[model samples]
Target: MQTNQTYDLLTQVQRIASGDESAFASLFYQFGPRLHSYLTGITKSETAEEELVQNTFIRLAASFPVDRNSKSFRLDLPGGQQ
Candidate 1:
């Protein structure tokens, strides 16, 4: 069950890499709130959190690739790899 979910997620990533805006939006919706919370916790600034979250998604979209090995896929941060 858990593995199936992971597989589905990887498929979504591939779709995103293929220029699927809806897939990317889904990714944003799924991860955005948690990411925002994490950024807010670290910086303790709402504005910074908003900026960082936006930056994160932009970077993610730019870095996306169809053939990427999903098992190793991760979001990188401007502050550094995270």
Candidate 2:
């Protein structure tokens, strides 16, 4: 059974896939900071972290309308394996 938060995220992803800019903004504001922190820890550079996070969202914007048959959504990193 999905929890409220999971359902909410799925709704947001669906909105984002439909080109809902406000939903994009909402998800960004909701997850960006924590994503940044995690990236910063791994890369150890603020510049890289910022770039990475931006690239992430860019990929997200283009790669949505997700595949329902897939058990999970994939976010490919720069020059990284798909």
Candidate 3:
């Protein structure tokens, strides 16, 4: 049985795959603190961790295929199909 956190994460993944920014934001908000803690524990550099977090999110956003048919969404991402 999946817990609420797991279930929510799964739902957010599905939404994000369909280019849901809200879902992605939810996922970021949910994971950022945990990721920060883990990164800090390993690297012990807050600046590096912060930069990595932003870069990681930017790369991740670029990687996902945008759903332009999603109610005239903003963000003119290239390399995606309808």
Which candidate leads in TM-score? 1
Residue 30 deviation, candidate 2, in Å?
Answer: 1.0
For candidate 2, the TM-score is 0.72
Off by over 4 Å in 3: 1-5, 71-82
**For candidate 1, what is the lDDT?**
0.74
Worst 10 residues of 3 by lDDT: 73-82
Give the alpha carbon lDDT tens digit for every residue of 19-45 in model 1.
666777788888888998878769998
TM-score of each: 0.74, 0.72, 0.68
Residue 35, candidate 2: Cα error in Å is 0.8
Per-residue CA lDDT of model 2 for 1-82, tens digit only, reads: 3699999999998876765667777887788888998987699998888788878877776777755654444344333334
For every candidate in turn, the CA RMSD to the true structure comes to 7.7, 7.8, 6.5
How far off is residue 24 in model 1, in Å?
A: 0.2
lDDT of each: 0.74, 0.73, 0.67
Candidate 2, after superposition: displacement of residue 49 in Å?
A: 0.5
RMSD of 1: 7.7
**Residue 32 displacement in candidate 3 (angstroms):** 0.5
| Candidate 3 collision pairs | none
Ranking by TM-score: 1, 2, 3
- As a whole number from 0 to 100, the lDDT of residue 8 in candidate 2 is 97
